[model samples]
Target: MIIKIFSLNLRMQGKKTYQEKLFACFSLSERVPKDNFYRQLGGVLDLEYLYGLTRAYYGTSGQESVDPVVFFKLCLVGYLENIISDRKLISHCSMRMDILYFIGYDIDDELPWHSTISRTRQLFPESLFEEVFTKVLALCISKGMVSGHTQAIDSAPVKANASMDSLELKVPKEDLESHLQKIRHISRMDKPHRQAKENKASKTQQTIDANKQELGAIKSRNKNWSKNQDQRPGAGNKGSKYTSNKTHYSPTDPDARISVKLRQSEKTQLYESAKCRHCPPCHHRYSSLPCR
Candidate 1:
């Protein structure tokens, strides 16, 4: 049998030049697909009631604010897209045709400034947000997307804005040295550093409220934690020693409390440095211990 060999040629296109063009017939609604998520969401979600709900929050005079419906739609987009930053969310929304259409803005129409979104969010009360959430949840329930019978709550600890290094020992009525000797596992090599630049904590917060029994328990837990931590990698790292909310607090954020969570597979303890807001007394009591 005779054999034949074939050669294939591939064509490479040249660099394309981009330029802006004006078109009178351009329409954002037509550009986005009918089945697009944003399109369907926009069609089903009616947020016009927000005008009446939030009318009291606005003034009758002065400059006009961002549309309530548009602002909320942008927030919904951010939540659905998992965008945590306002600046980033605005930039991302500006780049998407579907998002612009969903928010009722044309290609040339400018989205509200990121700061406007933040200010608008703060302007609305928590009750307003809850009401909006309830309405959305009801919509979902009606659409058969939610069972409305059962709900699961997440108790995961979120990382705070405070740093571990900024933690300061809580002052007790007793001598400072004696108190430190009781609770802290001070390494010989650990050098003393300058005190916190500022202590924002009130006088009541500065003093340790934990009783002797609580202090003793903390001391015992610190000793064991220090011993086990020495076996782990980066053991000598600063801030590796266990510090409890019962003994230490962040000077930068007085309300922030230290929380710990353990990895099941590695059996290693991970500390969520601090909480940005004040937690309840019951929450603070359990937050110091390692969460499963």
Candidate 2:
């Protein structure tokens, strides 16, 4: 009788597992070079100015608030790193030694919870953020990185999430007093822009003429409502391409406007035409019936 035996082939396999390390030398600052960009930023930026701006929001009797400077630094890290999600920003910062050093945190220090970042963001006024932005911009200008001259703006098309079929005719402005009031109220509730407007009123007014020109262009386009079906690029489907904001408006959203590519070439104006001789029903060429 032959016996069949199974032997396990287990030597040493590298598998992922969790283990507690009894000892380790951890120094975040030591790991990060002195010439690192974050370190350089920390050295150059004097964030103590923020404490005065943020002081009124904190109570003297309550538990300590997150350091205003550190909070802003964390926000800057998120912006520079392009980490839009708050949770991911915190996670990313936690993993980077340079960031920890920049934030003045020790290796073992636990970063503030993501919710804290959100709450702190809400608590601060927009002026504070603007102040930070202006300071950084001025610094960049001084460093010759950004020219404080004429700046050009650009945009790309983003398909709307809402359906075009839900569009409705716009109500006349004279009939929208209540609607306008509601919109103003909603705008007031959005603290950031409101506060920024209050703080930088003069700067905003300086661009009024430019804004008016843009508005006038939009108004002209809305009024004209040119047919651009043949001119629109990548128009694989057949239909009208341009719709006027004046003639058709989306009642579902006051801000929604139909946009089309305005740039066109003479080639885009190509039209298809056909001509054919009319034949009689009896298969003779145009016999007597006016020969249309």
Candidate 3:
């Protein structure tokens, strides 16, 4: 039994989880003299010109000075390659030497706090992201690889930040109020929810089913609010959504839509084919799409 356990442990340990592979492979075998992520970036973008264009927001008089270029590069990569959130991005950088090298941070350096990353993002406008993208495209143009004849674009369904199980379509007056009250009560009591500790000792998944069930019931009571609203008194109710369909999607469900669409961005006559805006990459393009 001890050997069996030992064998099982080794087998489990052998199961490899992929760290994010840098797919925007700025590196290649027959590399040109100038070949680094930034070099590749320069080949695809005009970094200095865009940075010059970015309106710098001065930090508070006493706040510690942050390296904006570093912060911007971190954010740029975070978007170019979709990681779910700033936390995951920083976590990857904290562990991966390649990411550390790309970001110009030391391998041993402590990762920036997730909150710091989020706060820094709020300091700039969306134009920064657009400018950065365009700069890269400019480099792609310089490489004489910019294709204007044909374009390919597609869309996919992505899970939203909010859990569908946590959302209600109609949210009846009584039900919405009830949930608000329940959450308030929980907040007031500040009950300790040590699910992690309990699971370790008991070797069972500590249940949040009760809370989840309660939320689910509230959602059911909302009575396909979207459907009902459209039918009730008509003013193009097809678009009348209190929240998004994706918002109610749950990350836990294996059956949930896994969105991964790749397409070519079209070329346009306008010098600026991109616009600047700060947004979570997953939802950014879909912002123009209707709620449905």
**Which portions of model 1 show Cα errors greater than 4 Å?**
1-23, 148-157, 165-242, 250-292
Give each model a TM-score.
0.61, 0.54, 0.41
Per-model lDDT: 0.69, 0.58, 0.46
Worst 10 residues of 1 by lDDT: 1-10
Q: Report the C-alpha lDDT of model 3 over 76-190, residue by residue, as the tens digit.
A: 7787667859888888667755556656566445767888888877877888777666776777667766534333334434433322222212222345566545432321232
Backbone clashes in model 2, listed as residue pairs:
none
lDDT of 1 by residue, 149-234 (tens): 33323355555556655566566766767766754444322444234678788766766766898767766755665465542112
Which 10 residues in a row give candidate 2 its minimum summed lDDT? 192-201
Models ranked on TM-score: 1, 2, 3
Better candidate number, 1 or 2, judged by TM-score: 1
TM-score of model 3 (CA atoms): 0.41
Best by TM-score: 1
Ranking by lDDT: 1, 2, 3
